[model samples]
Target: MVRGKTQIKRIENSTSRQVTFSKRRKGLLKKAFELSVLCDAEVALIVFSPSGKLFEFSSSSATSTTERYRKCIKNLRPSKQMDDSQHFEEEVAILRKKIELLEETKRKFLGDGLDSSSIDELEQIEHQLEKSLRIIRSRKILLFCERINQLKEEGKILRKKNAELREKYEERQLELSIGQQFSSLEQVKEVETQLFIGLPNR
Candidate 1:
């Protein structure tokens, strides 16, 4: 008769647990040794018991096997990290150079550091300044022309007003002169009538 499969569970009793640990440890070590011998391979195994006792097995020298494992892991480290470091350094150098150029340009604009400039640099600066000066002078001339035109318009308006006022003044003077002449003629007629009335011979 085929027996039922055994149910696997942790042993509750401390003594039974310890006994199971011992048996399993031996079985694992024996299997590791058999596999290494049959396959002609290197193998290492280590276990620690609940009682703090150490157990180990190795087909070769354990220390040498551990050292070899460490070396292999070290060799497997990604080479990309070194490449990234080199790239970062190159970018930093480029940024530093850019910053230096910007500082020099700023100094030139402030007119503080021109002694070290080459002839070509001086010529370039002079050309740039001359271009700017030309633009400023052009703008200034345009503004002056606009102001002159405005003043001329205002002068024309003033002259027209002055002509109208002068015409009005001349008309007023002519009216006053005509009224004085009429008064003078009436006075002469009055004097003549008085003379005729006062004279005896008619």
Candidate 2:
């Protein structure tokens, strides 16, 4: 049936809105079901009314539909770790450019020997190189210092554990020594008794 062309706006009447929502929801679900059954295609739809009521439909169970959605979306997504690695590569490229400039300055300093004009240029290049070298040295020192600190911390922890183990080992050794002493005393007493029994009258 050809109904009158309706203006696309919010229906002011609550009852009319509710009626339209119900009818449209049913029609949408019907179309989805028909598409899935006739075309053998997977279909999913979720709807929420302005009143905060939820209505959902899927060709599969709710859990299966969510799983399918995840699979579909993830296939189109880029990995985060790969993106971060690319950023790191870009930073490395900038550092490479700095190195290239430093090398060029060095070649100019050497190939074109230091005259008055060359000396001025040499001094400028030297200053820039010193700055770069200082930065590089500082970074290297920091890296090594951090590594040394980590090693020292590890050594401290190991020493504490070694002290604990040494105490335990000494305690075990003392116990074993006491046990051996008891065993020796018992042996001596047995020998004494045997000697006394075999002795002439005292």
Candidate 3:
């Protein structure tokens, strides 16, 4: 059967907890000693039990090792801070130079700082301006063509509407003419009925 993984929490039973602590403490000290020997390095470890008992290990004298550690940390802090400060200053200087160059280029483009410019530089600026003008003219022509096509479509729609209106008007005029002719025939019939010859009944 596969063993279950142990949960990492405080052991409830005092006896078990004590046994585990003792075993782990011995293992930790052994590992520290091996590391120092194999790597030829300075190593130190300190542990305190719940009963206030001190347990410690050091590759050399504990006092000397701790003092050396303190000195190394103290010496490294200032130099690291100085290095960061210098790096920040260098970055700021580089950015300032870039900004200055951009501003100078803008001035040259505006024809304000050309006293020191060479003939080649002036010719390059002129060529750039001509290219820009060509782009603008091309865009304008495209807009004009699009507008003309839109107007032509509108004219076609208007002509179609005019033809429809003319057809409707002609139909209405024909209906009126037929109604007038029918009314004239009805009047003639009435006049003939009224014209009886020479007989009067009292």
Candidate 4:
């Protein structure tokens, strides 16, 4: 029968857990030693047990190997920092060049630096200016049209008001004329009555 794979988990029993720790620790140390001897490599291993026991292995003096590892890491940090600094400098240079190009383009747009521009560049600028002018003119025309429409509406309102005022004035005049005619007829009747008050002159 094929043997079943053992499930790896924490051993709850103190004795069993200690036994497992001891076996694994020995096996790990043995592998470290073999790897160092077979590959002629510098190897270091360290382990701390649950009981605060220490186990360690090294192909050479442990303190020396640790020092070497620290020095190697320290050396690698400077190299990486230098690479990063160089990259930063390169980025700064690229940005500076871009800013200069943009400033030059701005000067050209403002018609300040045309002596250095080629024929094609001049033509491009000319085209851009023409397009800008066209846009400006179109906007101007639109504003004029809106203003004209606004004035037309205002004029129509004024004309309507004037017509209303004229109608009111005509009605007032007609009322005044009718009142004067009635007053005149009353005066004429009073004069004739006074003249025939006593007797006729014949």
71-105: candidate 4 lDDT, tens digit per residue:
98787877798899999999999999999999998
How do all models score by TM-score?
0.45, 0.38, 0.48, 0.50
lDDT of 1 by residue, 28-87 (tens): 999999999999888888898888999999999888889888898687647766888889
Task: Extract clashing residue pairs from model 1.
Answer: none
| Residue-by-residue lDDT tens digits, candidate 2, 1-202 | 8899988999999999999999999999999999989998888888999888888888877678889879876876477657878999999999999999778766765655345446677678788778989999999999999999999999999999999999999999999999999999989888743345565986
- Cα lDDT listed for each candidate: 0.90, 0.86, 0.92, 0.93
The superposed Cα distance between candidate 1 and the true structure at residue 121, in angstroms, equals 1.3
lDDT of 1 at 111: 82
Better of 1 and 3 by TM-score: 3
- Per-residue lDDT of 1-202 in model 3, one digit per residue for the tens? 9999988999999899889889999999999999999999999999997778899999998899999989887888787979999999999999999999889878988888999989998998889888988999999999999999999999999999999999999999999999999999999878744566776876
CA displacement after TM-score superposition, residue 157 of candidate 3 (Å): 2.3
Q: Best candidate per lDDT, number?
A: 4
Error of 2 at 55 (Å): 48
Kindly report which residue stretches of model 3 are placed more than 4 angstroms away from their true locations once superposed: 1-88, 193-202
